[model samples]
Target: MEIIPSNGEIFLGKEQSFICKSSVEATMKWLSGDDDEEIEDELGRYKKELIDETTLTLQVTASKVEPDRIIKCQAETESGETTNTEIKIRIIQKPTFVKDVSVTKVFNADSDAKLPCAVEGIPTPQVTWFRNDMPVPLLPGHLSATRDGTLTISKIQLSDAGMYYCQAYIRERNEIEHKNVTVTVNAAPMVTFEEPFPKITSKSNASFTCSVTGHPKPEIVWKKGEEVVSDDGQKYILSSNGLQLSITDLAKDDEGNYTCYASNSLGQQSTTLTLEVIDAPRGVGAGVVAGIILLIILGTLLAVDLTCYRTRRRGFLMFLSTSILGRPAPRVKLEDDLKKGTSDKSHVVNISGIDA
Candidate 1:
C-alpha cells in the first residue's frame, strides 16, 4: 500500500486529504499514529471513503487538523493481514491583531510621538508602517520603528500630521492585516489679516477680518491702543464666531493702528492693522467757505443802501418846511431898504394903515 501525498502543508481553516491505493481488493480503515484501535470516522471533520475496491481516501476537515499531526490509512485483506501508509500534516495560521490601534493621537509641535501595533501569529509576522496611505521610508533621525512594532517620530511638525497605518503580513498564509491611526500636531497660534485697514470717510461703514490657525482653535480679540474692543451693537459689532470686527458710522477717532491677537494654550501671536481716515477734498471745502463769505458781503451792501435812502428823504423834508414858513420877511426887508429914505416920513402912516 502507498499514500498519494507523502507530506502536506495547509493553512489553518482549510481542508486536506490523503489517499491510499492497494493492488488487490481489501477492507480499508483509517488509524492514528501508533494506535492499535482503528480510528472512527467522524461525520464531517474526519471521514473514510472508498473510491473503488482497490482505493481508499481519508479526509480531514479544517477544524479536525492540528499542526504536526500524522494521518494513517490502513487496508485489511480478507485473510486478516493489514498494510498501512502514513502522511504528515503541517498547519499554518495567519497573523491577527492582538490590540487595535488608537484612532487618534495628539502631539505638540517639535515633540516626539509614538504609535504601537501588536500582533500574534505563527512564524512571526512582519509589521510595516505607512503614512497617508503611502509607504514611510526609514529615516534615521526623523522616523524609526521599535522591535515591538511601534513607530516613533522625533521633532514632530505640522507636516507630519496625517493618517498612519500599521500592516502585519504573513507570507506563509498569504494574508495581510491593517490598523489605522490619525496623528494630530498642535502648533502655536498663527494670525493673518486679509487686508490692511482701509481708508474710510466719516459716517461710512468698515470691517476688519483676521484669519487664524492652530491645533486647539485659538481665540481672537480686537484691540485699539491699550483698550480692548467690545461689540456695541449700534456702531461696533463682533462677528458670530468673533473672527471679524465691524464698525458703522466710522469717525476720525477710529482711524489708528488696530491689533488682532490670537491666543491658545500653545502660544500667542498678534498682527497690526493700519487704518487711515481722510477728510473731504480741499477744493470742495474751499468752495463752500467762499460761497458763505460772498453771501455775507452782498447782504451788508444792501443794508447800507437802504439806510442812505432814508436819510436823504428826511433831510429834504426839513429844508422844504423851513422855506415855506420863513420866506416873506426876507422879501419885505429888501424892498424897504430901497425906499428907506423916502418911507421914513411915510412909515408912520403905513403902520397906521397896517393896523387898520
Candidate 2:
C-alpha cells in the first residue's frame, strides 16, 4: 500500500486531502496522530470517503495543528496481514496579531517614540514600519525596527507626527497583518519680542507686538509685573488677533516690565519687555522762585556800593566809621618836622575846636 502524498503540508483554516491506494483489492482505513486516533466518516471537520475497493480518501480541516503529526493509511489483505503507510503533516499558520490592533501614541517633539506590533505565526512574522503606505527607511538609531516587533524613532520631530502602520508579514505565505497607529508630536511655544526695551514719552501712546511659534497654536497673554493685564478698551487695548498690546496716555506708573506669555498643550514660554517713559518738562516750584528773588537783591546792593566808591569820595561807606571809644569821626593832619634839625615830630590835640 502507498499514500498519494509522501508528506502533507496544509495552511491554517484550509482543507487538505490524502489518498491511499493498494496494489490489489483490500480493506482501507486511516488513522491520525501519535495515539493512532481512528478516522471515521464525517467526524466533525474531518471526512472519509471510499473512492474504490482499493482506494481510500481522508479530508481534514483543523484550526490548530502544531508541530508535526503522522497520518497512517492501513490496508488488510485476504491473508489477514496488515500494511500501513504514513505521511507527516505540518500546519502552516498565517500571520496574526497578539497585541492591540488599534493604537494611538503621543510624544513630545525631539523625544524618542516606540511603536509595537507583536505578532505570531507558524514561521515567526517579520515586522516593518510604514508611513503613507510606504516602507520606512532604516536609519540606524534614529529610525529602526527591532526583532521583537518594535519600531523605534529617536529624536522625533514635528514632521514625524502622522499615521503609521506596524505591519507583520509572512513572506512564504504572502500573508500580511498590520496595526494602525496614530502618532502625535507636541512642540513647546517659543515667544520673542522684537523690541525688548521700548521707550516712549509720558502722556503718549505706545504699542508692543509679540512673535510666537509653536505647535497647536499657543495662546497669548499679557502681564505687568505679577498681575495679569486686562484690556480696558480705552487705556489698555489688545489687537483683534491678540498678538499686540497698545497703551494710550502712557504714564510713569506704566513704565515697569511687561511680559508676553505664550502657552500651548505641550509647554509655555514668556518674554519680558521694559517700558521706559520719559517725563516732560514742568513749571518751576515756590522754593526756586524764592531763591531767584534773593539772588537779585544781593546783586543790586553790590552794584550800588561799587558805583558810589568811584563817583563820591565820601560816600555811604565813609559815614559809618567811628573811634574805638564810640566817639564821632576824628580828622588829623600830617606835618613835616624840617623846622627841627633833629627830625622829631609833636602832636597837638584839638577837641571841640580847642587846642590842648
Candidate 3:
C-alpha cells in the first residue's frame, strides 16, 4: 500500500496524514521554532504538533510539554497506542526602511551651489532631480553629484534658477517619492555709460562704455542703429565693463546714437543713448568773451537787415512815383499855365450847366 501526505510533514498550515489500526488511541510530536531544545512558552508560541505523514494511524494530543506546562499544543488522532515521531518547523520575517527625509542646504544659480539630502526606505530608494518637470542635466563642470546623493551646479545661470524637485525610487513594491526647492538667481544686468547721452567729444579719441553687471553674468551687445560695430577679432567682445565699443576717430556719423543690450538665461534687459558730437570750440586761446562778442554782433546785424527791408516794403509805391515824376515844378508856374490855356479852350465841365 502507498501513503502520501501533502508536505510529507505535519504543520498547522500544511495538510498532514493519519495511519492507525482498527481505530485505536495514539500520540505524536513535532519540533517547532529554531530551538534545538524543547520550546518554552515564555520564549515561543504554538506547541510542537505531530501528525502521521502516512495513513491516519495514530490518535495523539497533549495539554502540556515536559520542559514547561505553559508551552502547549493540541492534537487529536485515532489508532492503537504506538510509538510517536516528532516533527520540525521554522520561523522568520523580511527587512524595512524609514521616511521623512530632505536636503540640508539650498542652492543658487550661475554661481556654484551644492546640497546633500537624506534618504530612507526599504531597499535603499533611488534619487534624482527635476526642474520645471524636466530632468535637469547634472553634468560635471556645469553640474556634478556626490556618493551620498548630493547635486551640485557650477557657474549657475538665471535659467538654472527655478523650482527644482528631487525624486526617490524603490523598485520592490514599485514606490516613487518627491521633494522640491525653489531658487532665484539675480536681477538683469544694468547698462550705463561713463558719460551721459549726447556725449561731448574732445580731439582725443572718444570712448563709450556700457556698465554691465548681474549674477551668473550677462552677455552684452553694442549696436549703432541696425549695424553692429566690430571690436577685437569678432564683431562682439565681452567684459565686466559691459560691451566695450571703441572708435578711434570721432566722426559726425558716430554722433547719432548707440545702444547696449544685456542678455542672460533669465531673460533680456536693455538701454539706449543719443550721442551728440559737439566739437570742443576750436581754441580756448580766443577766450569765452570773444565768442560771446561774436554772437552779439551777428545778432545785431540780423536785426538791422530786417528793419530796413520792412520799411522799404511798406512805402514802396509812393517812393517809386515821386522819383520818376519829380513832383510838378512847385505849383505857381502850374497855376499860370492852367489859367492862360484853359480860357481859350473853355475850361468849364458840362456838369456846371446842370448845377451851380
In the range 1-356, model 1's lDDT, one tens digit per residue, is: 88877766655677778788898899887777756466778865677788998898877766643557676777889999888777776676677777878589999988989888888766678999988677888799999999789898999888888899999898866789898899999999888887776777777788889988787888888898778989999878999878899988887888888888999999999998888877755455788898998788556545543443454444533443234224242211101223555644211101111111
lDDT of 2 by residue, 1-356 (tens): 88877658878778888899999888888987587778776654578899998999988775675677888998888888888899988888777888785777989888999888878888888888899999998999799888887889999987788999888888986888888999988899888999999988899899999998778889999999999888999989999767899999989999999999999988999999999999977889999999998688556545544544654533543432222113332343323334567665543222242222
Off by over 4 Å in 1: 1-88, 122-126, 130-132, 136-140, 146-148, 171-174, 194-205, 279-356
Give candidate 2's error at residue 249 in angstroms.
19
**How large an RMSD does model 3 have?**
19.0
List the lowest-lDDT window of 10 residues for candidate 2. Answer: 320-329
- Tens-digit per-residue lDDT, 128-158, candidate 3: 7777888778676887877655678787775
Cα displacement (Å) at residue 307, model 3: 58
Instruction: List per-candidate RMSD values in Å.
Output: 19.7, 17.7, 19.0
The clash numbers for all candidates, in the given order, read 0, 0, 25
Off by over 4 Å in 3: 1-110, 186-356
Ranking by lDDT: 2, 1, 3
Per-candidate TM-scores read 0.56, 0.51, 0.34
lDDT accuracy of residue 205 in candidate 2 = 94
Error of 3 at 45 (Å): 13
Judged by lDDT, which candidate is best? 2
